[model samples]
Target: MFSHIQKIHFVGIGGIGMSGIAEVLLTLGYKVSGSDAQKTTITRRLRRRGAKVYYGHQRENLKNPHVVVYSSAIAPSNPEIVEARRLDIPLVARAEMLAELMRLKYGIAIAGTHGKTTVTSLIANILTQGGLDPTFVVGGKVKSLRTNARLGKGDFLVAEADESDRSFMHLSPTIAVVTNIDPEHMEHYRDYDELKNIFKEFCLKIPFYGVAVLCVDHPAVAAIAASFPKRFLTYGIHTKADFMAHKIKLYPFKSSFELKINGKSAGQWRINLMGSHHIQNALAAIAVGNELGIPLSSIKKGLSQFKGIGRRLEPLYKNEHQKIYVIDDYGHHPVEIRETLNAIRQTWPQARLIVIFQPHRYTRTKALFSDFTKIFDGTNELFITQIYAAGEPPIHGVSAKKLADNIHSNSFNVHYRENLNDVVHDVRGLVKKNTIVVTFGAGDVNKVGKQLSKMMKEMPLQ
Candidate 1:
């Protein structure tokens, strides 16, 4: 259906999802041009790959394009958007184009509020290692793939089905993996049920012969499995699932577990990734791999070889003490933060848990501030950074300091770092050896972890 398009313009092209799509289009020999608020590594990479990228949104950016694809962050008032409408060019949202592309391939959409990136990367790793060489697009960089987007000649296409703005509804995949559903995206979704129904719609889009991989750990996702007409495979830590991970052992830098499919012996598996959430993520991949008829041995090989995706409990380094562990994760949501913090606790129960959290998007912060207040229950020490405003204008009442104060009052040791530099200084001074320092966010907070790693490397041994 996209054959007629010679040129495509994207607004908000710097976004991970948008950049992944642009990479695929560039591989297909299309002239790609786009605009973003600022230059980022993703946009720089796109430009190096021969894409025409503009620094800021402009009406002229929409000129000479057969189609204009914009992200949910871009509104109707955006200059390019106005131009697209005035010029009468075909306009499509990012998700719509992504869905159209998936329809042409054997789509496998990995979706959930918490583990979408990890699960998507897991499946991509399995497919690539199995020699399927499927075209895969993930939100974060997977060390297994070496990149977020890869164009393969194989028929299979793997993507992360996003539920924000109800975007997951657009994808119809042969295999759909719903990791877990939690109350997120309160902006578009009225409540939990509204979000659940959106996922239900996404599941119904699968063909009768297709399979739905449901995470039995979450009742919301498990409940939606019944809505699908075709066979559904349930996977989780619990034995009740069709695919279950039992006797899971989570080490500081690695995890090992046994997999069982429908109460039958599958095999013992090991991955370099840490945490039980990752163990569950592996199960999701195994479910899809089995459905695609990949051998158990191949799946095992793939899972074993997978180092992990970047920014998902990705360990930077550790000193001889083995006491200091520096990790980064793209966990902007409260649910994700809770899980990551718990995972850290599991690996380092005796170590002091130090978390540097950067809240992304003003809307998300405003909508879920109360939820954020409760996320640090298990964390020993919390450092809140300045809000990472993706695009939304600051809501009048929301601020990082306010969230920090709430956490402090709610029985947690919390403090707000209004400035990143100040936060870095304080963290470096206060963080002692044997502290499990986790930097969590979807924004520039990742740089804090990197800076800490550099400083730690430069510091002399005590």
Candidate 2:
């Protein structure tokens, strides 16, 4: 489909996934122009790389692009889309363009509700170490890549196939990594079964020669395995699978595990990242390595060198004298929140856990408020920030304050802060000597963590 495309324009150019594709196209010598609702670091980086970027969507910005690609977030009434239709320029959803790009190479898509960013980063790291020079586009930043996307000459194209907006079904992947699927994005999907059907369709999109690597630990994931035409490769910590982690060891700052596959002992791989979820991510990467016939030692080496994906258990600072640590994560979903809190609990059981959570969207907050409340059971203290409206207008009865009130825990003292500065002050006052502050959310909540880290670093030792 992209064969006819020379000059391309992106409607949501600042999005991490969209920027990745735009960068790849630019590296391939295509003229790329795009307009975002606002400027971001990603957009600025694209500009540095010679892509024409406009600040806002306007009909005038759609001039002379052969093909126009847009994220699902772009409304149909967007000025660029309206202009594209009026000018008769070929239009495609971001997923369609992604699928077209995948068809030109050996595409490996990592799909899941949670863990897609980390898994893609792990596989990309392993591929990089194995001399594959693979190109990749993850939804989050990778510490290894120093960017969200990379342009490489190797035939491997690794991307996080997002299930949101039903975009995962568009790609025809050679190897698909299904991390785990849970009911999410209730706004788009009618029900749980509806979401499962979408995932089943995504699996069916894989060609006959393709392999689907599934997490058997999740019944939902395992149930969709049979939907694929090709035989599926399974991995997990529980139940017998093709790739499994055993003898797991998790420390305050890192984790180690022994990987086994096909009844043969693969070397033990250690990761510098935190969380048991990361160990599972490494298992998925090992499965990919085994599939591609990469040496176990190379896989282990790559995994050991892996730091982490940004905003996913990303450590920001540590002050020994103050006895405090700050971490940030993009875990807006309930399941992600649960896993992250649990991981931190295991890693730092002695430290007082203080979570600063910013609800991402009104729909998600409404749909999973109960689950969100229950997640705090594992944390000692919680601070709720105002909802990060990611273009979603606030619902009548739903807000972060309501969520804070509903969540019940013995040690959980929840407070609401509407402004970032107030939230920072509240957190600083709440944090004690032995505190591990974790900022959780998919939106600007990251800034909370960043600001806290800066404050901690600048504060005089006492």
Candidate 3:
């Protein structure tokens, strides 16, 4: 804690990562203020906790702040950032601030291209259930805790290390977990080799006495494990690892599998979360729990009781009378969409699976165009909307319609809707007695599922 720096302001404070850190700072009795382009529940919650919240950015928002923290989403040319620089005040990246917070505690940082949020939440929940009330700052809201961040009295500090901006490298944690590695955040690295190298470096940052948990199923991660020269634990289903899950059984909303430690059966475990991906996440938590001397019983209870994080296959609305269920997920990448849709298909094999997918970034859509075309095969009907720019200038040749056309060429039931309202309206008409609707993406496409769920609730049973 910086005694001299009393006030800390955040730019783009509404971001999940930014908000969590802000909440932690508030709990530490610091004067926290922040600005975002829009007011959200997270921002309002911070305001109620005595942090000054601003709806829009302005030079005046930076008044008398000892330091300013900005997320990767915020541009350097923003008014508040310019004002901070003009005033000669210290400026920090969001990851820099998070690194400082972890520096003081026995840190456990989770990093990967995907499943970081779920893995971090699982570890946090396991640690919490074991009676070590740890300080946690995750990217998504853990439904069990109802908040993304908490300052605890225990010695552990758990957080998700974001690699999208290559900022996760700044963190040096006592225990580090890398779920998997893929070709993502291409904007940050020169190539796939660079991305892999950075992860190797990140794991090596662990002290001699520390440990690194890795997933061996992903080839890239497996490669990193081969190169890592330190204490490490490996977990996966397809690959032989230190921690492994086998004999998996998948249900509509849950899965059970046998857990093995070092090729010996530890126990049978079940998780409410779906997909093989989630099972791998739980395995990471188990490795961490065992390493920290927590009983397997506590880890089992923690995994079983985890309600799941928001927007990671979160059930938005369920209508028993109408026999309709709606799920919202933040899966914009091709691999994520493929796995998520596969889980939905396995869960409800009889229901008509209708998907409303909004492509996340122009760059991502452009880079993974072919993969998107092939990933939606599990859906009965697929609706595509315009790409969510996510602050990037539109790429000239990339558009949602083109993606739809490419998918259509493969004889898939895909449609392009230029308007979200029209897509929602059409979805309302398309609902049948046995239907499961899911809105998929990293952007505002979730609004379509929410509105449709509301409309379904108001409809009477036939």
Candidate 4:
């Protein structure tokens, strides 16, 4: 705790990562203030926590702060950032602030192209169950905890390392985890090699006394373990690893697995989540908790109690009366979409699946277009919405319509709608009994899920 740093401002505070950090600072008795263009639940919660919240950015919003924190998504020209610089206030990248927090505690940072949020939340939940009272800043709302962050008294500090801009390198955690590496966030890196090398460097940042947990299931991630620079543990079902999970059983909203430590029986674990991927996330949590000397019983209990993170295959509405289910997820990347859909298929194999996918960033869409096109094979229907800019100027030839057109999945009906509301309207007619509709993206696409669920639920129960 920096006694001298009382007042801190965040430029893009509504972001999941930035909001969690701001909440932690607030709980630490700091005067927190921030601004974002959208008035969201996150901003409102910050205001309720006594942080000064501004709906829009302006120079006036930067009123005399000791330091300023900005997320990777914030533009350099943001008025609050510009004003803070002009006023000679310290400007800290969100990751830099996270690193500072990690420095003060027994850091357990989860980094990777995918499942960072889930893995971070998993470790935090497990440690909490172990009575460690860890401070954690998750990138999404933890459904069981009801908040993305907390300032606990324990030494362990759990958090997600944002690798979008190679910013995760700022963190040197006591324990590090990389869930998996994919070709993502290419807009910020020079090339794929740089991305992989950066992850390698992140694992190397582990202190000699620290542990780095990685999933060797991903070939790229497995390649990083060769001659790795630190004490590291590998977890997966496919490849031979230090930690492995087998006897996997995935239900609609739950999964069970048996763990083995270097071919020795550990214990059976259950997660209140779907997919073998989630089981893999739980493996990382198990590895870290065991390294920290937490009891295997405690680790098993935590994994069993993992309710899940917000917007991560979160069920919005399940009308038992009509049998229509709506799920909302922050699945923007191709790998995420593929895994989630596959999980849904295995969970509700007989249910018709309809997906409303809003492409997140133009750069991501352009970079992963071919991958995106091939992921909708089993979908009953696919609705592509206009790209959510996230402040990125539109890149030529990277529209959602183009993706829709290129998605020549004969097995599924694909359509593109430029308007979100129109997509919602169309979805109303698509959902019926035994249908599972998912809103997929890292943007405001959840709005469609919410609206569709509401409209569909209010209809007559025939």
Best by lDDT: 3
Top candidate (TM-score): 3
The alpha-carbon lDDT assigned to residue 283 of candidate 1 equals 92
Residue pairs in collision within model 2: none
Q: What does the lDDT come to for candidate 3?
A: 0.91
lDDT at 48, model 1: 94
Q: List the residue pairs that clash in candidate 3.
A: none
List model 3 lDDT by residue over 1-462, tens digit each: 659998999999999999999999999999999999898999999999889999899999987999999998998899999999999999999999999999889999999989999999999999999999999999899999889999999999999998999899889999999988889989888999999989999999999999999999999999988878898999999999999999998875689999999999987899999888899999999999999999999999999889999999988887666667889999999888888888888878878888999999999998889898888776788899999998888999999999988885343478899999999999888888778889989999999988887887787337
lDDT of 1 by residue, 380-399 (tens): 77899889987678999899
Candidate 3 residues lying further than 4 Å off, grouped into runs, are 320-323, 409-411
Off by over 4 Å in 4: 320-323
What TM-score should be assigned to candidate 3? 0.98
Per-model lDDT: 0.86, 0.86, 0.91, 0.88
TM-score of each: 0.96, 0.96, 0.98, 0.97
Worst 10-residue lDDT window, candidate 2: 222-231
1 or 4, which is superior by TM-score? 4
